[model samples]
Target: MADWQGVSEFVAVAETASFTKAAQRLGTSTAHVSRQVSLLEDRLDTRLLFRTTRRVSLTDEGDTYFQHCRLLLDGLREAESALTQLKESPRGQIKLTAPVTYGEQMIMPIILDFMIQYPDVEIDVDLTNNQLDLIDSGCDFAIRLGRLANSSLVCKRLATRKLIVCGSPTYLATNGTPHTLSELGQHNCLRGQHDYWRFREDGRERNIRISGSLRCNSGIALLDAAKQGSGLIQLPDYYLQTALDEGSVVRVLNNYQDLEEGIWALFPHRRLQPLRVKMLVAFLTDALTNKVL
Candidate 1:
């Protein structure tokens, strides 16, 4: 019969890649750690590690076992954490990533509400237009403003947003409103949406290739341009709403509007999601759905 303690030592050694380090982590002597691993190998009838004076490396079976064992242990820890958190409000630093524009114009309000409710939880929000590595950067969750292209990361839809072209009344008087996408080619159409403009024609969604003297990845900048009459810009509804309602920017091409884009919260796929991430996601969804943001 295989001793679970011995198996645990093998797993620790595989994780550390050093028996001495594994022993330190396991709070045991080096000899005991080595003996446990050796006994586990004997019981399993296979060598789990290739030991050397310099260091250690896992064998083929050991490599596969290590992955499974790590998942099992980590999943167990997360499961227990979930139970513990059910009785208490989630409290901890919730690391989040979001695009610069959406974070400021849309998510920030929701975040403020979340902070008010979970006073014990601290938020670390990274507002960048770049795609951040959630695992490498230690982000608990990310607010992605567009349709998620990566299948590897798990995503949940929070809300849907539409893009519309708008321009200040002053700019319209000078350059004129575009009746069609073809007309936009003749005017300064400030672009961003990954440098591609969303359009719809004949009941089919399309991307319009556009350019202008001013281009930016940030929606806030795009809105500012339209406000300044620098150019007609396409922007998400949330950013344009205040401008649109106040008549600062007038929406054009209302009939031929593109399909609504999704706002999603994404996390790295895992057997068990951390409590902080789940709370944040729920808070954001609730806050937005309730028209708080």
Candidate 2:
């Protein structure tokens, strides 16, 4: 009989090159991971790792063993996922990431609802504006907005969002509305993380470098500033929707508004996604497409 006792521990250590990180990934103590890897090496009668105070590295034999072990472990996970699908219930921990504001405003509600629907499922969500490397973070997927850089990850467009440039009526009255693309240079354009605003000119996408007194990363703060007649603002439709409807702000430069950009779900390349991930993606697609967001 093949004893599979420390294979996972050894693989984790090899992949992370740190017993501490492996232990963190496995939800165990560093001592336990070290002991398991030591036992694994004893059972195989081979040294698989070179450990120094600064770093850990795999031996040539360990590298060969890891290639096979990684594939085997992947197969094992797929088998378990397949079996779970047979039960007709998605159950497992799903780790994902999304933009902070949008995740809080839109994704979090849907996620909470999903949790209610599937009590067996677990979720760990990281909300940030920065694009995290899904593989390094061990996240199953990411929710990304606007233009995506070319990458090997699989992308599914869940929805589309229009960028609206608008300001409070008072601001428009005081500073004058920008009727042409060039006129935008004359007004105070509230800035976000980027110094540029996107538009469509002559049926082509254009980015205009904008400057303003306030430069903030928070959409809500910029929205408030616009409502208070601080300056013109460009933001996603969701952020400006309520204000636009309530007469707190009005759209300007409509002729130059950019076409809607995609809200995408990005996942690492894999032959088969776990059922839970598929379900969550489906749920998000439905919600966003139905204009629930």
Best candidate (score: lDDT): 2
> What 10-residue stretch in candidate 1 is worst by lDDT?
268-277
Q: State the lDDT of candidate 2 residue by residue for 1-293, as single tens digits.
A: 24788899998888777999889989999999999889989999999999999999999999998889888888988998788789878888999999999999889999999999999999999999889978669999999998999997889999999899999999999989889989988989999989999999999989999999999988999999999999999999879768888999999999998988899999975325789889999999998877622
Q: Global CA lDDT of candidate 1, please? A: 0.80
Q: What lDDT score goes with residue 239 in model 2?
A: 90
Worst lDDT run of 10 residues, candidate 2, spans 268-277
lDDT of each: 0.80, 0.89
Error of 2 at 133 (Å): 6.2
**How much is the lDDT of residue 227 in candidate 1?**
95
Per-residue lDDT of candidate 1, residues 168-277 (tens digit): 99999999888988887888888774666878899998888887888776778778888999988887788877788789999888877888888888886542466766
Q: How many Å off is the CA of 129 in candidate 2?
A: 3.9
Off by over 4 Å in 2: 1-10, 24-52, 56-69, 130-140, 148-155, 203-205, 267-273
